[model samples]
Target: MCRLIGAVSRHRAPVADLLGDDLDPFIRLACEHKDGWGLAFRQEDGTIGILRGIDRADDSDRLQHALKHQLTDMAVLHIRMASPNLAVTVNNTHPFGDARAAFAHNGEIRPVAALEKLIDPDLLATAAGTTDSERYYLAVRERMNRGVTPGDAITLTAQAITQSSDLVVSLNAMMLTPTGLYAYAQHDPHSEVIGRRGPAYFGLSYRQEEDLVVVASEGWPQPAGRWAALPDGEVAEFPALHP
Candidate 1:
């Protein structure tokens, strides 16, 4: 489980500018979700750039610097609360990807072995971490390799896992691609964790302004009227500016 924030803008801007007043509170979420942090953005050259640290976002000087210095028309941030048995390591941190795209997941799929079985062998060999989140990402990437759009890739992977795995708590995640940002939200409303964390635990919401669109996890004080919930079991795409 984790918290995520992502944005697509018409002009290059720092992520802090996109979050506005919500930045601090979002960072403070690391106080509880204190395992690792990561951020990914499109570089000037059009390649995806990522920075990750196995430290709480609230306390990481590196994160602080990036929040101020890094600027992009598209970006995604993740603060991880390591799932049971997952170690706190850089490789396990999020916003994982290659030059084409970046991804961060906010839920877990049980018996990760089952999900692993669905991934192509070559893709599986590239995994740098054991977290189900990584496998979940590779699953989507596998489909993308076959020419599927990011949103469809996510939906197909989610459907496949739910059909073959046990106890899929959620498949909520944000994928930042070369052209746009995609958010996927799918969770078991009746699950025990949702009951404990409240119905909004795995929920995702977005706010679209004239120049930018922002999507984020539920945790802090985003005004209900201003932020629209991204519908469950579906994917939402926000286009970003490109060279």
Candidate 2:
């Protein structure tokens, strides 16, 4: 479980601007989602990179520094609320990828032993840390190695994991490619799971304004009914609004 934000705009924009407020008074979320944080995107020179730290986003100078331009093209900002037993370290950060793609998740698929069994062996080999999020990315990459698109790969990989595991599954996730930002929101919709404050905060939402399309985890500050919830169990792409 975590908080995530992804955005794509025709013109360059800073991450802070897209995330709304830095020290948002929403219970100081940036300070609370303190497991780790990361920013991943295709740089202006066409190389993708990640700037991250295993520190609270509110305290991470790196997060603020990179966020100044994380949304430069297509990018994602992830503030982790790591699952139980997962270490709080840099290797376990989100938006896992290389120069061509990046992937992040806001949900959990438990029993790493079982999850790893279903994942591709090669992916497991390359894994630098132990996290369902990273393994999910590897599984998707395995599907992509067969020639399907990244979005399609994610869908297939997610389906495989769901069928293989009996544990509760929440696949709210996002992937950044040169073409667009593809996100998936799937979980138990009617569960009594929610903050003591309101509805489930793990859902994904987005809003498009003129030339920019923004996606974020629920519970972030947004005007009433301004954000659109992503369809459950579906994969959708948010291309640059001006593209």
lDDT of each: 0.90, 0.76
Weakest ten-residue segment in model 1 by summed lDDT: 234-243
Give per-residue CA lDDT, model 2, range 179-234, as digits (tens).
77899988755444443324657678788777778787776566647788888888
Q: Clashing residue pairs, candidate 1?
A: none
lDDT of 1 at 238: 84
Compared with the true structure, the alpha-carbon lDDT of candidate 2 equals 0.76
**Candidate 1 per-residue lDDT over residues 101-133, each given as its tens digit:** 999999888998998998999999999988899
In Å, residue 182's CA in model 1 sits off its true spot by: 0.4
Query: TM-score per candidate, in order?
Result: 0.98, 0.89
